[model samples]
Target: MENTSTTLTMTRRFDVTAEKVFDAWLNPEMMKKWFFTMEPTNKVTKNDPRVGGSWEIVDHREGKDYRAIGEYIEVDPPSKLVFTFKMPQFSDMEDRISVEIKPVENGCEMTFTQIIVIPHEEGWTEGDIEKAHNEYSSQTEQGWYYMFLGLKQLVETGKVKYPS
Candidate 1:
């Protein structure tokens, strides 16, 4: 049995231009401004926005290495990014996680989703898909909620807060 959960979609609407919003995600310097939760706290020490480039991040936690590794399969500046996500201690059931950005009326609409199953070591089984979804729904939603909030604040007001 395998358990799986999907983030379905996390869309954010901003008042800034699509180009600026896009750069917020593609530009390494600009990205570091609001990409993570906030503090510069989690530094994406190594970021390669180009296709096939690898990325790495280190969370200044007690013992957490919040890293993102793997090759970028697709990269369309200010539009789409598809990459495989991995770490030394934990691995996603599905190797890929992708984010698509589209220009909205006055800004950008980002649709983020992940094709993955729960970590096998968590005692997840095939019939636990719904359970997995239910358990992860809140945390996952909150994550994106804060993420968009952080991005919105930074882009609109030049403010950033990490781990909020």
Candidate 2:
């Protein structure tokens, strides 16, 4: 397998305690409200939050199911989380996501990183590879930004209002 990759990092501050913010990530109910907004709704089929535990989110839309699966690599309550993320359609690749929540006055700062490993296709030029990598990073950044906005709204108002 050819090796081509990109890392997307985002930082956000939420007006909530570190524990609260961190809980929102691992809690299945809370994740259902903010994670993966591309679809209309989702079901958290499995949410075992611990080292080696697995989680699966199934997006339900148009009478179809789109699922994403992951395994927890590390879990430090109220502080840090690391996981291996994968989508079945891209079975050849697995990505690693890390989240660090630091306590700050009036709230917390969350640093999120996702390292995506893109398959290097044969016969692709350097320019083609760069373009594809940039596009993937941009889309991932936008998607997570919106999800974080949803998370912020939910944490502040106790309701889900994803940004448009």
Candidate 3:
């Protein structure tokens, strides 16, 4: 059995143009600079910014290599992007991420949301599943929070530092 979780929404305003912000998300070079805050160093990044295109990033940290893969579902340059995201470590679990960028007087407002699904594993009770789901949700939320911070810093200051 598989269960879908509630949508997690995050909003942030960046002091950059909508195109700039959107490009940063799709551009491989820009993303390499600030994709994963915890593992800022990526071994490789392959991004093809177009509908039906795929992207992947491999990160090395603490002597372990983690990889995330995603595909573009919808791409509206400078305005919106929808994608499917998954990390291989999570067995049979995938999520959808939607990003909406709106031009503001100062810069741009980005509304981000991810719809997550947790897969059921054999021998796990209801309580155990819920507990695992909650823990994963919390950690995911925190990771994105910091990743956004890195994105903002990169857009604003033109540089970012990720702990090594």
Candidate 4:
């Protein structure tokens, strides 16, 4: 069976320096404030911000822990980052995410992209693949939208006013 993939890209402008925006993605303390859609009761972030390094974030919400693990494919400070992302509880499939930041007139503009690969099984139709792609794309986009809002608030105001 052949595998299918979908790519989704989102861009947001931040009223902060490029370095600040980029650091928010790799800094453990910054991530704890703006990474998730809902604030986790407890969170642990371990990051090695270099090419070939690994990173993990485990958020404890309610009584369960959700883990996000990945390896750094590329890490260029204040400009670009590329990493693999996976949640063991969700699926075995791993996705690729890339973040690019550029200086604008006032602050910076960030473009984020996620590539999701779907494994195809026997007897799966085109419609089935399309449905899976659409569902994942929509959910991921929405999740990032909220996370970006939180990141913006934290970087611009020194506090996360909008948790979600």
Evaluate all candidate structures by whole-model CA lDDT and list the values in order: 0.65, 0.85, 0.84, 0.86
Model 3 is weakest, by summed lDDT over 10 consecutive residues, at 33-42
Better of 2 and 4 by lDDT: 4
For every model shown, what is its TM-score relative to the native structure?
0.77, 0.92, 0.89, 0.92
38, model 2: CA deviation in Å?
7.9
lDDT of 1 by residue, 1-164 (tens): 44444655666778777667666766666555555434545666567778888766555556565665567788887778887765555555445667777787877777777654554335545566566676666665675677778788778887776553
Clashing pairs in 1: 1-125, 1-126, 2-125, 2-126, 38-161, 38-162, 39-162
- Top lDDT hit: 4
Off by over 4 Å in 1: 1-7, 92-95, 120-127, 162-164
Tens digits of per-residue lDDT for model 4, 20-130: 999999888888877752345536788898999988888887688988889999998899999999998977889999999999999999999999887778798889988
For residue 44, what is the lDDT in candidate 2?
50
- Give the 10-residue window scoring lowest on summed lDDT in candidate 1: 115-124
lDDT of 2 by residue, 38-146 (tens): 3347755568999999988888767877788889999998999999988896575789999999999999999999998877678889998998899889988997988
